[model samples]
Target: MMSRLRITEIFYSLQGEARSVGWPTVFIRLTGCPLRCSYCDTTYAFQGGEWLSLDEILRQVASYDCRHVCVTGGEPLAQKACAELLTKLCDAGYAVSLETSGALDISVADTRVSRVMDLKTPSSGEVSKNDYTNIEHLQEQDQVKFVIADRADYDWSCAQVSEHDLTSRCEVLYSPVQGKLAPRQLADWILADHLPVRMQVQMHKLLWGDKPGH
Candidate 1:
């Protein structure tokens, strides 16, 4: 029997966030997340999705004819077969990336796949789920993202950056929650402190506004 994964949806669109942002990419959003972040946007992926075998998944991705592929979730790592999927994508020669909640063990991922892990902020209400141990495993190509929703979250995020010396290990990304925090305010705070992390907004959201498949 072939390995199968619970897939939420798979579509071709511009990479929305992370290092690959703005590039035309294929998104493989998996089903089921263990944590419920307060500002979750892809809540639709929490449950109810179709299951596809590895061959079928790769076939659809090939049909897209794009070079960049992002394996994201409702915590894609929640599925045992997700690691295999990442490895298969890499073996197929796609510039693959994985968008995962930092709550899970990222060590299981393929080294070739860029890991875009998130550190849930205080405002997200699920900050406790962060597995800080994953930081040590970060490759230079990996990224750590902080989804800021308020001043408290921003300050806490800065503290994590300092405490972990994250910049020295990998690229750090600072993103403001869609409405709770103004993009300009987050930008000003980063400038005021001269934070080295890259600031990014949800480009897809700005273009498509919560529309799935992008």
Candidate 2:
């Protein structure tokens, strides 16, 4: 028999971030993570969760009758079976996206699923854990995100964008860490510097729900 995945929760909400932002999407929150990113909001998923089989997961997802699905986690890629799940979701015909920290190999994920990967910023404390090799795997449908918490993080992210030519590889996202960096300030920097990236403020702008999930 195949292994059951540890699931923190599954719920429906408008996607709070990324290109699929504002889409009514089912979020599959997998349990566990390896890195301790300082600004993580989903620390609740780090510990206890219920184990769920993929078939049951699909059944619950279909119950929602939504066309979009986002498989997220404390770190979704932390679970090896996540790839299998992604493929199953895609095969089932739901438009799927995977939100992951750029600390693991992304090549294993199904090509049909869009990947929204994060490159840890200095303030995240997991910057050094970033696997630069993953850059080469990014496709046009994919995205690279940098969660900025300070001016230093912004500057460092710009350098990474320039050094890697990230915009040409895929869409680059610059998101402010709520309460740490002001959204307007980040927007100004992007404009003044002429940074080729998308500036997203999910809570301030995109979120129709009271709070973000996963």
Candidate 3:
């Protein structure tokens, strides 16, 4: 039997986060994650998903007729087959991106896939899990995200950005943890610090109020 990947959810919707926010995109949320960040919103994706082969996933994605595809997870990189999935998507001629927690070795991922890596901040509790080596894997097309929950997290993220020179490597994004830090407060901090990183809100959360598979 051909091996298949465990998938938590797959749907077509507007890109609700990162630099691609608001763009029509297809989301492939894979199951399982090793880390449990304090403010994790998609904890539901941790378990209970159907398994599907790469070809089957592509067929389903093609039915959406959208060119932009985002393969995300509870940490999609945790599954070895995710790399294969990304390769297949690129071979199929779709603009693909992978949203991953920066805790994994991303150097093995296909170069054609833009990596949106999440660097956990101090407040996330999973901050120690960040594999700093992933920083070297970033390219201009890739992006780094820091979800800040408060002033401490924001400060830590700023330090990491400067220390890693992430702005030159890829687009840096700083987003406030919903209901934890006010968006306006985070915006003001970004401005005051003169940080080059882009400030973003969870656009889907604003629209759907934490609805799943959005």
lDDT of 3 by residue, 39-116 (tens): 999999999899999889999999999999999989899999999999999999998999999899998789999999
TM-score of each: 0.99, 0.96, 0.98
Q: Who is ahead in TM-score, 2 or 3?
A: 3
Q: Write the per-residue lDDT of candidate 2 for residues 58-172, one digit (tens) a residue.
A: 9999999999999999899999999999999999999999999999999999999899999999999999999999999999999999999999999999999999999999999
Off by over 4 Å in 1: none
Candidate with maximal lDDT? 1
Quality of model 2 by C-alpha lDDT: 0.92
Q: Cα RMSDs of all predictions?
A: 0.6, 1.7, 0.9
Q: Write the per-residue lDDT of candidate 1 for residues 3-106, one digit (tens) a residue.
A: 99999999999987988889999999999999999999989999999999999999999999999999998999999999999999999999999999789999
- lDDT, candidate 2, residue 157? 98
Off by over 4 Å in 2: 204-214
* Candidate 3 local lDDT, residue 189: 90
Global lDDT of each candidate: 0.95, 0.92, 0.92
State each candidate's clash count: 0, 0, 0
